[model samples]
Each structure stands twice: as structure tokens, then as C-alpha cells.
Target: MQTASFVGFIRTLFYILAFYYIFKFLAKLFLPFLLKKVVQKAETKFQQQQQYRPDNSWNKTTTEQEVFYKPPTSQNRSSTKKVGDYVDYEEID
Candidate 1:
């Protein structure tokens, strides 16, 4: 019984080590994708700030609508016939 328990403990230890290394490997693979997404978002925000300048004496309405979605008019609605094509469920935040 003692020998069996020792073998089981070693097996559990090996499995834990394997899981740790597997997680590390996965993180290494996915970290670049996460960084790329963050960098792209930062670039977009920076560009938007430059483009929407309130101090530049521009007469544009600055009441920033966070999401600018064009509601489908009768002409567009008639053209779209798919069942799940033009449905907007989530709030446009």
C-alpha cells in the first residue's frame, strides 16, 4: 500500500508539472495576439483624438455618438431577405 501511494503521488506531481508547462506554452502563443489587439486599439483611439479636434475651430457637432449605426431604411430592409442578417440585439455601446 505504501509503494502504491508513493507511485500515485509521483504521477500526480508529473501531471501538475505537465499542466504548468502546457499553460506557459499556450500563454506564449496567445500573448502576441493579445498585444496586437491592444496596440491596434491604441492606434485607433489616437487617430480619433487627432481627427476630432475641438480646439481647431471646427463647426462640427461634437456630441459624440459612441456607436454610429445606420438604421435600415425601407429600401434597405426590402433588399435584405435573410432571417438573421440585420438584427441588432446588443446596445450600441
Candidate 2:
């Protein structure tokens, strides 16, 4: 049977920490370039799509029209109606 050693554990931990820092450093250096290229590609694609689309000249109207909305009014009544009865409750300690 084999037992776990302190030196092996420490070496593994050191390797993990080193890899983390190296990856972080590399990401910082390369992430911006990757993001910028992606953005430029998306922008070019958007421009090309816009160019292929038809103009919205038909949507524009020469005359402007006003719109009016009237809400429904309720009738006045003297009597009041109850929907439900109120229940009284006591809390026990």
C-alpha cells in the first residue's frame, strides 16, 4: 500500500497555481485581439446585410395623422356590493 506524501501534494499545488497565473496572463494578452477581430467581423456582416436590404421609403408617409383614445366611463351608483366576507383569526403561542 502507498501513502500520500506532503512533498507531492505541495508540488501539485505549486503546478496548479503556476498554470493558473500563466493562463491568466496569456488571456489578458490575447483576449482583446480576439474580441476586436470578432467585433470587426460582426460589423462587416451587419454592413453587408444592410446593403442587401431594401430601403424603407414605403413606410414613410407624406401626411401626419392625429390619434385619439377615449376610455370607458362607469356609471355612478348609490349601493355598494360586497365580493367576499372578511375572516378574523387569532394566533396561538
Candidate 3:
């Protein structure tokens, strides 16, 4: 079996660092283009949805609905019951 050497270790480290930098550089170049496309697609989808949505103005009628409310009668009024006693507390410094 071959043994680990300093040269091999240095070569592996160099490869890893090179790959990392290359990937980072490529991402920086392409990420914005990808993000812009995604945003444009989303915007188009939103506009399409807005266009397809039914207009609320056409569905609304000019007729006014009258609402009537009657006050509670004395027979329907509930009696109040005492539930608990209140205790007053003084703060001590």
C-alpha cells in the first residue's frame, strides 16, 4: 500500500481550493441571469392571473340592502351575578 505524503496532501488541497474558486466565479456570473429569468417568469404569471380574474364591478348591483336591528326587550335581559371579591394590594419597596 502507498503511504500518505506531503506532496499528495498539497495537491489535493490545491485541487479543492481551485474547484471552490471556479465554482464561486461561475455562480457569480450565472446566478443573476437565472434570478432575472425567474423574476420575469413570476411577473408574467402574475399578470396572466390578473388578466384572467373576473371583474368585480360587473357583478356589483346598485340596489341598497336595508338592515333593521331591534333593541333587546326587558323580558330577554339577563340578571347580573357577583362572581368574586376584589382584593387591593400595596407594593412594598
lDDT for each candidate structure: 0.85, 0.91, 0.92
Candidate 2 C-alpha RMSD relative to the actual structure: 4.6
Best by lDDT: 3
Q: Sum up the clashes in candidate 2.
A: 0
What TM-score do all the candidates reach, one by one? 0.46, 0.65, 0.55
Residues 25-73, model 3: lDDT tens digits: 9999999999999999999999898778887566668788898999877
Q: How many clashing residue pairs, candidate 3?
A: 0
In Å, residue 27's CA in model 2 sits off its true spot by 1.1
Backbone clashes, each candidate: 0, 0, 0
Per-residue error for 54 in candidate 3, Å, reads 2.1
For residue 84, model 1's alpha carbon misses the true position, in angstroms, by 91
TM-score of 3: 0.55
TM-score top scorer:
2
Residues 12-79 of candidate 1 have per-residue lDDT tens digits of 99999999999999999999999999999999999899788767556655886689899877653454
**Candidate 2 error regions (>4 Å):** 57-68, 71-80, 84-93
